[model samples]
Target: MSEGTGAVTNAGEGEEVLQPFSVTIGATVPTGFEHTAAEEVKEKIGAEASISKDRGRIYFEITTDNLPKVHHLKSVDNLFVVVKCYDNYQFKDTKEDALLDLQEIAPVLPWSNALEVWKLNNSVKKKRSRRRGAAPKPKPSGDDSEGEKLQAETSMSEETEEQGEVCPEQDMSLQREQNSETIENKPLKFRVTCNRAGDKHSFTSNDAARDFGGAVQEFFQWKADMTKFDVEVLLNIHNNEVVIGIALTEESLHRRNITHFGPTTLRSTLAYGMLRLSKPQISDVIVDPMCGTGAIPLEGVIEWSHSFFLSGDNHDMAVSRTVNNINHIVKRRQTGGSTSPGLPIDTVQWDLCHLPMRTSSVDIITTDMPFGKRMGSKKKNWDLYPSCLREMARVCRPSTGRAVLLTQDKKCFQKALLRMSGLWRKTHTVWVNVGGLHAGVFVLLRTGAIFGSTPENKRESQKASETQVEDMMENI
Candidate 1:
């Protein structure tokens, strides 16, 4: 989200001392992708970074002099620098006692004009958006429905009521939460997520949480902005403990600067995670046959300097988008950026079922295949999967080469896998939560040869495979 790409910034600084500080930063990722995100954190941010994950989120504790490097980490959604972790956050505790607790934490934290505060412990889980042309899905609603609206009114009403308190520094951002159906239907301009967990002794009611939020605004001198906010703060409360930190970037890190995108452009973070799991090495010829807008190859070139990329898609529009995005990357590189030369790269527009490649020519492959309700046809995939897998097997190097494919059509994909059990071996399968869909990421190793595998031979096998697929789909 921030402009820089995780490089050392401001070496001669005030807070960064000779002895690097022990800092805790939060990294968020799509569900079940924490392992890969944690790897990115260690590789990009700190060599000795201690990482932990909860609810698909990562918390990294590292002793580092360079904080900007952490800011530039890919495969992460949001980044937070922890200011404090408290043992107790009882807003309903005695007024004097609550004030005292907030006082101790206030001075150490660097306050912003506008703050987006959230609870990590008892936070609400957001509902995912529905695929296009599918049913009109509901928005992600959290349990703290009224809590948000209450927090907003209380902040504005209370602040305005205490009309005469004169303060020298006024960096308050006025952010109010609206709970109306009209506002809810529209995309959220800004959001403050509250996570409440561990020990019910603190919040006697939802107002208790609202009051605490007001206390935070008052202590930090932050103004609530219903329209917008400059910073996001995560409050993690575990039992009697609470940890607070401000986001390192204004927007989520997953939102890259790529100017062009396809209808199904893969998430940059997911693309990075897939590459990491692909076990790419020097001289590895990696590929993404379904490469939409070049996220996979673009991320690959940036992270793996030794590898070359072959990105292709069946759609002409996808190819155009990828080319445009590559040009932008090149422009950025000229003005001094971290991405490797976008050289040793090639693009193609062809049918996935009939790829033009030599047997055992490619070293590795990774692609985000079509999924979702309307995005892909389960019936068509029955024919497409086997054909595409055969072509992919023909291209990848035998015995040692690998691929990481993501798709939500588990039944169809598994049917294809079962039919071609000898050609590819499934090494790992991880179910990742993407836009509310449980996408299975398959890591397959090229085990059998496919130089002259005839497509005609599959007609007989198709009849049997379809029967098994139907049964599997029923159980699913």
Candidate 2:
């Protein structure tokens, strides 16, 4: 389908499939955030039709005509793409190495020249790599203390001669020039977020790295090392327009879709947690009770092959949105006449407080609990929060399945866990900034007591022992 073997420059009217193409992605923002992100990508290359929030990930289909123009923009060392390949409907990793790769898998394009814009930052960085430390202090010649004094006198005499030749006004002008030179010599560390809406190529910098870090502290929330950043500010620049994004990561990239919801899976935050478990299964069944908006459930459904995903949410609107989401995902998979349920998702409307399922049924439960102030209604948040967790313990299989839940209120969830007779065991904690709000993820395990112990008589014995332990801990 390509026009020819050689690389094509302009995406002219050619019936060719050989040319390369890319998809530009963006993340979450206020109401009007995507215009900047989209315009930035458009300025890089020509686009056909834009798909906003198709499946949690904002997508755009671009023509191959802008291949050369876009490819010229890449400067990063190891640019890769996160996609769900043809063989699978899950988000998988791919290398954006050559034009052929982009063309062969042309259905999914890079989020408006992501690699190219990322490379532009790399080039800028390379240009700014000026080393420091006063060159090497010239080794002192073998001279006694008196010799040093004589050298100082000679330098003073030279300065006096130079000063005498210039008028007072000229002296001031020369001093100003020297100061300007000094300022120029000081390091310039400009930090600008390149992926924000409508403000892509803008940057700001102080004369030094430390000062710049201080200046952008509020912008970046830089907790640790300043290095290891790809583009300090994410640059979604394509065709010359730019968007500014700060402290950009994979999660931020997924969230940048202005017209659509973010990806169901393969996002940085959720993916990191899933990978951490390192559990082995032949397409494990992951459930998300109280699956609002179907983010985690859809992600789980797409992450692996032969995986079974069951999602439930009490909200009717959420259920409708999720249904449309699932349909869109399936249609996208069937677009090129492909058939593979790499990760199939199943959805239902079920309240977490009283899940309509049996014990030891589900494998893993990962959900972002509805936070009162930010997401859920107050009275329902208070009532549903604890009850939902107790139901999680009731339905999960003992010792075989684990629960990873994220919430801003740890004390409430902790109390819920304690009251349930130690049904869930706390595993790990991860801190995340969701929409600029702080939250912690508590990974829990459904213990034997919650799902019913092994043998009939042994089950009662285990329950008594767990009760005793809980009582002692509560008393202490």
Candidate 3:
């Protein structure tokens, strides 16, 4: 192993090789939500996940090698098979040295490269044999004939080559084939995905990773007649170290296909994290008053089948989007999709500050509050947050009832919660990354007692009441 590069070299005399089947697979969760995501993995995934967190990402490991099984986890932002990690690597800082270090740490092409090397030696051996008047021995034609194997491999390769590159259908088939076959064989098809997270670099991390990728491509194609494998190699370079992994899902799981549209619709992963934080019960009556696109309620439907969900948004367009997505989500589940059968969902078009449900009815309230950027104004949020939270406290079951609110306006939300401190008790406050927005998800437990209005509240109330009476008298 190289001290500067943290690169592992082949053993000279006696060495143990890593088995391909023993690869480590893990999930990448949103920033500031590692503990929740990891808990979900342990509970839902049941893999006893090991967590490693970075600034904006969390890497989790499981015992199982089944990448597909863990790929579609709701809370996971991305899933990948950890290919290699260079611990405490000392980057030489120069582009040339970085490329060399990357190349050194990259996973070895045991099947392709070793076979190519052997083939080269045989090619020279064949020439010598021709000079000595000796021809290669024939492979017997039976179930294990070399001819059949070569033909099958050739057909598979040609189909992949004909597809040009990045063939999904071929890639899936190749993954299954590779997993089933223990024998050393070339990879089907492959690509490279590199991510660099640091500042003031000597060279672009992309160029360094790509240079390494290109070198890998060259190494596999060195002496082989044909090579086709579509493996998306992931390189996460940061903190003078490179953590390499293979992307499990072609597209991110966060991009829920069910949600076709929503300008301010919350991301599914964030919704999932909030729901998990709330610790919802199957018997709980859940609601998301500002359910712009129903991402939260939709996730609830998929996650827990028995929970009763009531979602609403005051805006007509937002309600329409939510309704359409809800219908689509149900339809997908009904048509043998992965989601479980949830009870009928109720959609409403009502204001969050004034919900239609009776007081102390709802057991849980989970909502993505307006961030004042795309949906609502920060000035308006001062009043809206307080009113919405008060209404939530009114509807919540008090004491046992909980509301998990996601918002970027942390200061305003805290103020609102503090103003109506008697109505609810703050249980937890978590900072999470939804895309790039630094947001907080506050969990509050409703305190059943409805305290009398304070002197300030009374005066404000009296002024509003007097104005209302005057308006009524004038109208009469």
| Most lDDT-accurate candidate | 3
Candidate 2 Cα deviation (angstroms), residue 25: 18
TM for every model, in the order presented, reads 0.68, 0.45, 0.74
Q: What is the lDDT of every predicted structure here?
A: 0.59, 0.42, 0.61
- Candidate 2 at 135: error in angstroms? 54
Candidate 2 at 141: error in angstroms?
A: 75
| Models sorted by TM-score, best on top | 3, 1, 2
Model 3 lDDT tens row, 149-240 = 00001211222111110111111112321122222464435555556666745656557656666666676542222333344455676666
lDDT of 1 by residue, 74-148 (tens): 767665666655544455456556545544565555432112122111011011111111232222111211100
Which prediction has more favorable lDDT, 2 or 3? 3
Q: Could you tell me the lDDT of residue 71 within candidate 1? A: 47
**List of clashing residue pairs for candidate 3:** 188-228, 188-229, 189-229, 189-230, 189-231, 190-229, 190-230, 190-231, 191-231, 372-376
